[model samples]
Target: MNAKKKDPIKSLGIYCHVPFCVKKCAYCDFCSFSGQNSQTIADYFKALQQEIRSFALARFNSDVGDLAFPVVDTIYFGGGTPSSVSPEYIQKTMAVINEVFTVSEAAEKTIEINPGTLSASKAESYKAAGFNRVSVGLQVWQDELLKMLGRVHQQSDFIQCMEILRSVGFNNISVDVMYGLPGQKLEDLTATLAELMAFSPTHLSCYSLILEAGTPMTNLVKAGRLVLPSEDLEREMHWTIDRFLKAHGYSHYEISSYCRPGYESRHNLKYWEMVPYLGFGLGASGFYNGVRSVNTSDLKEYGRLIAAGKSPAKYEPPMSEGELMSEWMFLGLRKLNGIDDADFKKQFNRSFFAIYQEAIDSLLKAELLVQDGSVLRLTPKGQDFENQVSLAFF
Candidate 1:
């Protein structure tokens, strides 16, 4: 008898990285820069379009005899700041994507914006270009904190941007805020949440500040010119915001993300669920068909590769089965609900407990994990040390 045939993967997510910003924040180490001429920006867009088309054509050619083309269920335009570019650039990219791929009728499209760069016309253009979700970066509420973080936008700018987005008929808006900043107080966070609640954004991503190595913020801390909040204070700030958001009708769906019912980020959830995605543009990464790939970070290199009709991917290594399982556990556990045992077994053809019984037993004994029937999740205490729990799988 012939062996059973496996099903082909479908329903991909597309991520486009727009590596431009009006100004680089002190804490940011992303591959984005400020102050480029219009010609440079225009050239980058041309290369980006060529790369998108080339990738699509290659994917289509590979799937020649397949029953159905892979459908794109989500598209995320992440930044530096996607809104930094002119709206026409966004429209042209969307046009290219639609020309090459089959975008699902109910696809979720999202774009990131910085309050300092968002304008009313741009907001309207985004809506017209089929961006149904908008995430605005409003790192903090206080002007002093904003300046300390080297953000160009003041508190007033964020409020005004929110107003513009609303007036332009954007219903699904997510606001990004941060905690654990230098000299941040509990009252400051509370006040920020209060003001944000007034806007009634559908989603909130409240992240704790991490002092990455070699960033300006880290240098200042090392030089004793800046002092971050104490660990206790940071923890307090995290839980305080979580509880407050829950009380205000936002579900803490993920460790750092809270959303109203049905407003969770579809594209980001794909990452946690191990769904395949295609990534375009400088420094973007993608995981598809058992392979993980990253585009080159250098603009000149990326442009050169695309111009030569070559793949701009700097790396494309297929993941081993063990690596895939480890990633599944690590990403799945990041969700507030944790990993589903049944789903794990279905995906890997192995029982979760059978593979990680010792690790599970140890965590259970340590009161870090709790098993409730088919689901395994982090305890409230475990959530505080999630890194430790995730490391167990490794």
Candidate 2:
């Protein structure tokens, strides 16, 4: 077999999606289900394993024959509540990954868990399987709000889950919280943050509630049965949380993420830095060798393709250079430290100012952007209107 040369510049991140949930949230449009049969979940795992094996064999054989797979630096098990499934399944999947990929000794492995599904046994399994990070979806600390969001777990469940994780020796924990719900007040958000601070999680993902099309929450709002917080109020909520978290010693590294110093989400940082990653499972997406691809969302179709030794990719498009540059600025600006002009030049071999001078000048004039030394970052005003700033690059 002819060996395919390894690309020294390429670093790999792996994302495995688990699409089974005990109950789907009202506002969630992600590919996940409620009350799926055990047999279906089992079959999906089988198909997922097959897909993983097939992908490894094909990538290893294609032009890079017999070469070891790239060293994976990060592995993320994201969900429909990864903890909803049996821990044994997670163990088996990890074993398959270990067999095929050279996972780094210092790799950051994370799994997203819903408080309702986590148990001491599950936490032990995760620890034994080499998972170092656990991200719990606690969307809101208020029990009433949790019920309104159709979450299966209450505030007590969240606390217990945290206890179990800590008991099993998982130090790196992240909590997912949301603001700007239908009846959520600024005081509600403030109280939630206070409670979260008490827990002292390593990381926090604070997201503003978005009314996606066709979601139950949107439907209720459209029917005049629910009232979402006004845009101004939502903006206020964002700044409030930002101020609170920063004052408490959390770095607002990304627009919607805060972390204790040295605890930023490594896997998520890869996306913002435009590092290559492979995603597996139904409806998962990946960016590999400059091509972006998404897997089939239809479970039956995905299973059939894997069984036939065919790629499950529903879309795989090579990004144009202009598109890539646009992405570079958009994603980089998401970080508080923002884009380094030197790094941009190194990646694209083009002067950043030459390409974006007009946009930069206009934004700087509007006080929406600021440049310090070699770094250009979003101003406080710019962070508020991030969507507008991102569009300027496009």
Q: Report, for every candidate in turn, its global Cα lDDT versus the true structure.
A: 0.89, 0.89
Off by over 4 Å in 1: 1-9, 62-67
What is every candidate's alpha-carbon RMSD to the true fold?
4.0, 2.1
Error of 1 at 80 (Å): 0.8
For residues 1-394, could you state the per-residue lDDT of candidate 1 as single tens digits? Answer: 1111234348999999899999989999998989988888898989998888878766664545344468889999998889999999999998888777878879999999999999999999999889999999998999999999999899999989999999999999999999999999999999999999999999999999999999999999999999999999999999999889999999998888999999999999999988999899999999888788999999999989999999988656688888999889878888888888899988999988888889889988898889988788888778788889889999
Model 2: per-residue lDDT, tens digit, 305-353? 8888898986556899998999999899999999988999999999778
Off by over 4 Å in 2: 1-9, 62-68
Q: Provide the TM-score for each candidate, comma-separated.
A: 0.96, 0.96
Clash count of each predicted structure: 0, 2
Model 1 superposed RMSD (Cα): 4.0
